[model samples]
Target: RTHLDPSDTLELRSAADARQQWIHYESLTRDLSLSLTEQLRLILAPTLATKMRGDFRTGKRLNIKRIIPYIASQYKRDKIWMRRSVPSKRSYQIMLAVDDSKSMGESGSGSLAFETLVMVSKSLSMLEVGQICVVGFGENVKVAHDFETPFGSDAGPKIFQNFGFEQSRTDVTKLVRESIELFRTARTKTSSSPADLWQMQLIISDGVCDSSEHEPIRRLLREALEERIMMVFVIVDDVRNKKKGESVMDLKEAKFVKDESTGVSKVKVERYLDTFPFQYYLIVSDVKELPGVLATLLRQWFAEVVESSN
Candidate 1:
């Protein structure tokens, strides 16, 4: 990890140094490209097919019976063609909100986060999955890339190189609000595409939210819940083995009840985030494990699409 100090700016090497570092990291993680490609090949197409219907304009494989009838009619003006059924693609717009605060640079978390970012960006770009938006946020937000351009083409290096430790605050609510606007913009532009557009946002943080912004953030979460946008918070940290076994991944909920003959009582439950359209995952310190963990979570996310489609 390269720690940059205020006085070190001029003393350090030039832009060439940063570019070389980026290139080196890319070369090192090159194997992940092939590995992610195979996983995507097995997951993307088939999963979409299970849920989406084929585009109507594209004809399916010729049905023998329909073909015979058309042939008997000497290819008459009768429209007797069966369009091939393909996956009715439900476009998933994924926005990755990465934390680039000073704290992230501690505990080796920055490197882990960057590694995960590269793996995911390259993987999704390779598969050409729905719109991929990567944003690095701390005090404010920095959009590293959007769906209009490929992930690692021109934006990837900038995202990695521009990550500084100055900005330290996290405004998650604002980020979500901005992401919603982004989705709305895309929706308007792609009105001709299928209506099955699913919105999913992944937040890479250290299980910390600005205390003062909690209420507003929860409100934004509720709004997201109503909009059916799946919010996934990926906490990049070490695991805590508590006797209660309650991890940060669990959502807190309160239940109220009254016994008609007796009295009223309140109950609290630590449950999975099924009641809301959101969930959280904990990523251990092992950076290499991130790719597999992400792949598994994405598979689960795609499974939700399948179930909803049915």
Candidate 2:
């Protein structure tokens, strides 16, 4: 064994601690990522099946399943036979915005948020749907990953290396505006395709929108809507330690709560969300529940796409 000074020993121990924490985070998220990936893949598979391009009219090939209906029509319904086409692959574009405010470092929220980002981003990217961009925001916002690069190739290492929770406050509105510009830049650099219709932004935070920027967020929401970009806020509300009798909000939304102990956790969230609400929002107790919540959200969205294709 080699002898070392006190400073050198302390430095080595600090490095060991950091490495251990990194492994802990990575291992925790890896399993969740795999589970979510399989769930999403199954949900998306149905959409890849034959979709009706036209029916009750002329088309390339007649669907055999419709023959019975065609015959029952007494040959009057020529359009009973359907024109069908199967999409080779479904593609999508998604952006993930995570709040890295100082508060995030509280109650282990920062670790939870970081794990959420890695799991969701990895699962989605594994599906090979399209590119995903990630942004971490607090007093300021910056891209953790850009749309120009592949998530696995470049964004992965950059995200893992650069994650820090040193911001003083959260600025939800600023993040929204910046994302719009980022999207615009992305559009310019890439060729237009059907995947453009699937563009979406998911903002993840353990807190509600900044009430100070209420008006600015309202304005930005309109622009985001007009652009046909889907915006979803995944709000993580930690109600685990709350008193059993106390409610997050009014008891009305409580009726919908699956947790009898919590009563209406999301109802309380609903009030805060009013400041900067999107039509699509999700609530969960912690980042650990994200695998299921995210899978359900994507399944619902993909279902809509399948319906529209018909």
Candidate 3:
């Protein structure tokens, strides 16, 4: 279960506009026969369902949980189980590491990152499964929310409001290191089978890192791999257009860079792509496309896992 952070400013719309957006989001979820909890239904009730239908009319016809089985059978050609007995199934934890550095404030790009967070949170909520921990870091790291089941709108709103008060100051190295430490501690406290748990570390950032702390970041990745945590880095490229008219730049032009001889020698690039025991890297130029991108990646990831198990 995951709690989503609501937008700081309720994207209040005209009655007509609200009706339209509700219909759009609802139509997307309707086909699955996925019932939103009473709270979610109420929150979205003010808007007409018809409007939400059009946006997802042709959107990916995939549920978050289905991705694993689809990928397992298609890509890996392996038998994959869609549902496992709760006791036998591994607990899945998604540790989110968000960038809060000074650079993050440069282009008013935070809104895009915020939107990605919201979308991901919403998707996770719909799944109503897994343990999720949302962490924010800049100069320091803090756990914004932790959930063992899907959260309601009130809970989601609180998480988002807390995020609004959190400012960026921590470096990526510290953020990564702290997150790994937290996971380790949490693992020890929970008397669950480590093998049964599918741990994922998701880093969302603009791919910028503090050069001086290169070694620490490398070591952090190594430690995460040693613990059997699957690390995923989602590079949030700056959006091309914003209300502030921010210009988008190619990833190469951005801070992330690679050195042939040293292999990810630049701290930013190195931290961005540091190898892990089982890892995946995704670079997305637009936030709007993130949900689909994440779905694709998850499918590929689970396919590999299922194949290996077989």
Q: Summarize candidate 1's per-residue lDDT along 167-282 as a digit string, tens digits.
A: 66766777878877776776676644545676778787665554446567678877876777777777776443222334334535455656667786756463434332235464
- What's the true lDDT of residue 213 in model 2? 78
Q: What are the lDDT scores of the predictions, listed in order? A: 0.64, 0.70, 0.56
Q: Enumerate residue pairs that collide in model 2.
A: 56-79, 57-79
How many clashes show up per model?
A: 8, 2, 14
Ranking by TM-score: 2, 1, 3
Stretches of candidate 2 exceeding 4 Å from the true structure: 1-22, 44-46, 52-83, 192-197, 240-271, 274-276, 302-310
* Candidate 3 per-residue lDDT over residues 48-72, each given as its tens digit: 3222111121342323554576576
Which candidate achieves the best TM-score against the true structure?
2
Of candidates 2 and 1, the better by lDDT:
2
Clash count in backbone of candidate 3: 14
Better of 2 and 3 by lDDT: 2
| Model 1, TM vs. native | 0.67
lDDT measured at residue 196 in model 1 versus the true structure, 0 to 100: 68
RMSD (Å) of each candidate, 1 decimal = 7.2, 9.7, 15.6
